[model samples]
Target: MKNKRLIQKRRELKLTQKQVALAIEISQSMLSLAESGDRTLDDANKIKLAKFYRVTVEWLFFEEFYD
Candidate 1:
């Protein structure tokens, strides 16, 4: 699934792709690929994003399904 939560969190914080990428030490294009779900975040990057957004890794990357 696409990382809608990640997109939402960034938007909610009024952050630009470049801003986030710079803060997290990645290229803007890399972050774009991640946000678009064309690339997966490795564990280290996941931790960085979660910390940057003040959320848990699960909240950033997991989708809850209803039974």
Candidate 2:
């Protein structure tokens, strides 16, 4: 639920889970876990994701976008 936007943004960038994982210094399994809503991102990961996506942290987590 919370990370749905992250998934969308990644897809929009044409990036695979492995690619994003590498960018965030995480493993593919961890990325998969986050995408599946099985886990939440820690503070470090939140920062990494925000930087990697070039979006604000609030935007990454809370902004709604049209599909």
Candidate 3:
């Protein structure tokens, strides 16, 4: 799922939750919730994260769920 992928990519990039939150202009709590699958990202944020990770939006948003 997107949540798992987000967490995975965050780890791969060696980004602390605070670092990822700051880069994405979100709060650390929000990022934590997102990684735990307690919340879903807004479309704009999905796009931003995709770009940050150099991944296609499809890969970031729907890869695990859809494919």
- On lDDT, the candidate that comes out on top is 1
lDDT of 1 by residue, 1-67 (tens): 5688889999999999999999999999988888888999899999999999999888888756411
Candidate 3, residues 1-67, lDDT tens digits: the string is 2377788898999989899889979889887887787888788888888888888778776756565
lDDT of 2 by residue, 1-67 (tens): 6478889889999999999998878999988888877888788898899898898888886556533
lDDT of each: 0.88, 0.84, 0.81
Residue 31, candidate 2: C-alpha displacement in angstroms: 0.9
Q: Which candidate is the best by TM-score?
A: 1
TM-score of each: 0.89, 0.83, 0.83
10 Cα displacement, candidate 2 (Å): 0.4
Off by over 4 Å in 3: 65-67
Model 3's alpha-carbon lDDT is: 0.81
Number of colliding residue pairs in model 3 = 0
Ranking by TM-score: 1, 2, 3
Q: Candidate 2, after superposition: displacement of residue 26 in Å?
A: 0.5
Model 2: residue 4 alpha-carbon error in angstroms: 1.5
Report model 1's TM-score to 2 decimal places: 0.89
Ten contiguous residues with the weakest lDDT in model 3: 58-67
Candidate 2 deviant stretches above 4 angstroms:
63-67
